[model samples]
Target: MVQEGLERLMDRIVLAYSGGLDTSVAIPWLAEKYGAEIVTVTMDLGQGKELDDARERALALGAVRAHVLDLRNEFARDFVLPALQAGAVYEQRYPLATALGRPLIARHLVEIARLENASVVAHGCGTEKGNDAIRIDLAVRALNPDLEVLEPLGVWDVTKQEKVAFAKKRGIPVPAGADSPYTTDVNLWGRSIEYGVLDDPWLEPPDDVYVLTRAPKDAPDLPAYVEIEFERGVPVAINGVTLSLVELISSLETIAGVHGVGRIDLLENRLGDTKSREIYEAPAGVLLHAAHNELQKYVTPRDLARLASEVGVRYADLVYNGDWYSHTREAMDALVAKVQERVTGAIRLKLFKGDHRVVGRTSPFGLYDQDRIAQSADTRPSLELRP
Candidate 1:
């Protein structure tokens, strides 16, 4: 039955394989169901060792070809930088970590589809009516309007448990425990956890659930002070130590995570029309956003900063709703680029017990004139200024 379906449309298929449960199962399922030549492409957006075994796992799962592209620098410069410059935080908190990564993944999927000349591009994104499906569909359609976009899970009229049972019956190796207490997404920016016990807002997140951030009570006794230097809105140095983008983020993550500086718990509206309680640990993101905002206080005028903040929220929504490649997003990017022109500066931050606060900020192109403001006649008391 599945074999016949594969035989009919199995000439070639390009899959955005993550080597996760669904994707790992999809590779073999597509090959068996469509008998198509499967080509897998995994984008290395700093997922660490999970990506290390991606090619091997893809081949092991019966993919004819596999490629893992290192997109760290491109992801940082192209996606992360623009979002950071715009101060695009969703719901005044989220850094749009996974949301920012999806478009790049879709772009790579399109490229791989073209390279493989695959008749169809497929993803393991289930019919959850979430941002993943929207992102992939929008990106693929924009890049190659004629290509076929396939979503197996969307059409599969089965529950997750049923899918697991079918895979097991077919001798498909599934990840340990088909059901997990939570669903987690991790990247360079942060880690977000949803589902399971989190559905109840009243319930406190288990201590073990937090991986990247130290517990507030467990944090160091003394405050840790650090200085971050930015060039055109991107961090280039930490505590006088110059580093590359990746190095800079990594360094900050280590420093901030230890102090429990970035943990957020919120009830956010998912794209799927549900109110979800999500917990995120984004130490570096917290530190960077605070430091950057502080730096802007010196470099950008009050009105410009306010406008940028407004635009940032809009930009965050667009990205979250899978409109990364939209015209409005491009315009917003241009506006952010202009704002970042003078956003070079150093921000001094103090971290202690799950908090990262700005203590001082300075910029070469600062719009601030402290001496003039201090001497302003408006600041003088009426009695002191009496003629």
Candidate 2:
């Protein structure tokens, strides 16, 4: 029986399927209940080889047309870059890993629905109380109000054990469980780890929970120095090596993770009721965010820097709430873009023992002189001002 509050029927539905446990179950559930052709769309945001089997999995599970899009570059440029410039971090700890992907995925789902001439789009998001269901629904509605959004799990009262049972009953193959015992979401930008034993805030996250970053204690003895160059707020080059955005971030994640630079185990306040303890491995984000923030200070005026900081907090909130398409977010992005015009600079940082220390920074619009700052100490340099 189809759950209440989701009664619109259609000839076909485009599902934002990830080939995960939830989505695998959704394919059959949608077919059984809606009696509509299921078209699965998987946006591949650099989840590695795990995505190779998505098309096969979707077809085997009951999808008629399975679309797998390589959206890695789009994810980086469209979503991650703005957040990077705005210094958007939820709760001052999370860099909005899963939150960032929702809008982009919703956009694709809507486009697929249009091409397929399907009035309904479906997703395997968590129940009604889950945060992602809100994000997906809001995004789909905002993009195309003509289309109807369906969330099967949002009304289906099924526990995890029951869901597992349902998958088994449907003959859906389950991925082998890891010993880490945590739910994980990964993309080109970052990784999110939560649930299970991580719910206890007092208990530190175990080493096995982190795959992108090494333990701080396990980091190499020697300090690794890296130079990151930004052009109008977007990362462009690393150590004078000019690479595409995707390549630069991927290289940085590897380099910084090996030095134990990006690991955050913090209590996150979710969009829905209740707080969550989530562990994140965002090696590149950790390195780049620091460089970008420091570069802003070097280029922008003191007053503007303070205002930008405030705007950054608001930007984080807007993204956290999945209000990316809202007018307020557009205004926020305008301000962030204005600030970023002057945020071009190169920041040198030392990565060691799970921490990044800014070593030096240089910008064409620098507001201060290093030599003058060193000479005056606490006193303001009486140097002549030049435009």
Candidate 3:
């Protein structure tokens, strides 16, 4: 139960509601416990039916109002494209999907709070004592420092199972089935699953946990070839077909998912002092990142690429740790903008089960000198390498 003083402190609260077990429970809890009016805001970053159900569920959970904002174009044009341009990847494998989505979601939550005249902004993120809470709170503070931030799960003195029981006791329908052996977060860039059975790093992930890519053994026998075109570092076309950013990414997901081209299982250092096992399925993102990196090899200088590589890791850390709206992230973005100026090209790739091999690449800005390096050229003895 909430303390009387805290309840008086928040008469109107704007919640980052997803209609999930945590946020759904939060809606009624804030109302009943604090006498607060709950206004739920759900951001649409191309998570599909999940967003739709969240809106419906928020209203059903006694929220005074529910707002679903379609931020797909913003997500693709702003977040995804910047990462693509920067060639940002966490540890050269994971596509910061949910990580990239956080700042935008928190931004909207703050905006809604301001518009609704809400004194507080609440989120479902539990007190994991990690970067996510820090990230959301930071954004909230930056946007509206006066708006008190409330995290029900952060303060709630109960285990996850206990929270589920509390929801059930209140007649809130949790997602069916006992929770999967892993906790999964999904968005446009990709899906990441971890925890539960995944804690045992030695054990292989069960088949049921995968949502995007097919298992390697189940992939097709023949290889598929794809050509990707880029302009100023953003993917514009695939296989010579031009598409909107969202369509292009979606098409790549379908194509690459079939070939089992993107699946990663690794142990990563979390914001806390522990290391956790994580599995990711990011077919399109993996393909694009590879192609983008290969293309950059031709256009970008080695020194700039090296610097960008370091910045890329820091950029990924910021996203993963929820500092998306911070000065460090903005500085990283500026660095990426400068480096991406020359990253214009097209790359051809051969895709097989769980593998993507770049066959060829072309760019108007290519640094490769065909005349000097051609296989048919005579071996000219030289005292020193020339630019």
Instruction: Give candidate 3's root-mean-square deviation (CA, Å).
Output: 3.9
What is the lDDT, from 0 to 100, of the residue 65 in candidate 1? 96
Higher-scoring candidate on TM-score, 2 or 3 = 2
Look at candidate 2 and give me any clashing residue pairs.
none
Arrange candidates by lDDT, highest first: which order? 2, 1, 3
- Model 1 misplaced regions, further than 4 Å: 1-8, 157-172, 176-179, 373-387
lDDT of 1 by residue, 43-113 (tens): 78876546777888889888999999999888888888788888889999899888888888888888888
lDDT of 2 at 284: 88
| Poorly placed runs, candidate 2 (over 4 Å) | 1-9, 178-180, 371-387
Q: Give the Å shift of residue 199 in candidate 2.
A: 1.4
lDDT of 1 at 26: 81
Cα deviation in Å at residue 38, candidate 1? 1.3
Q: For candidate 2, give the lDDT of residue 233.
A: 94
lDDT values, one for every candidate: 0.82, 0.86, 0.81
lDDT of 3 by residue, 279-369 (tens): 8888889999889889987888889878888887888877777777778878888888877788888999998987899999999999987
Q: Which one is best on TM-score?
A: 2
List, in order, the clash count of every candidate structure.
Answer: 5, 0, 0
Local error of candidate 3 at residue 73 (angstroms): 1.3
Candidate 3: lDDT of 130? 46
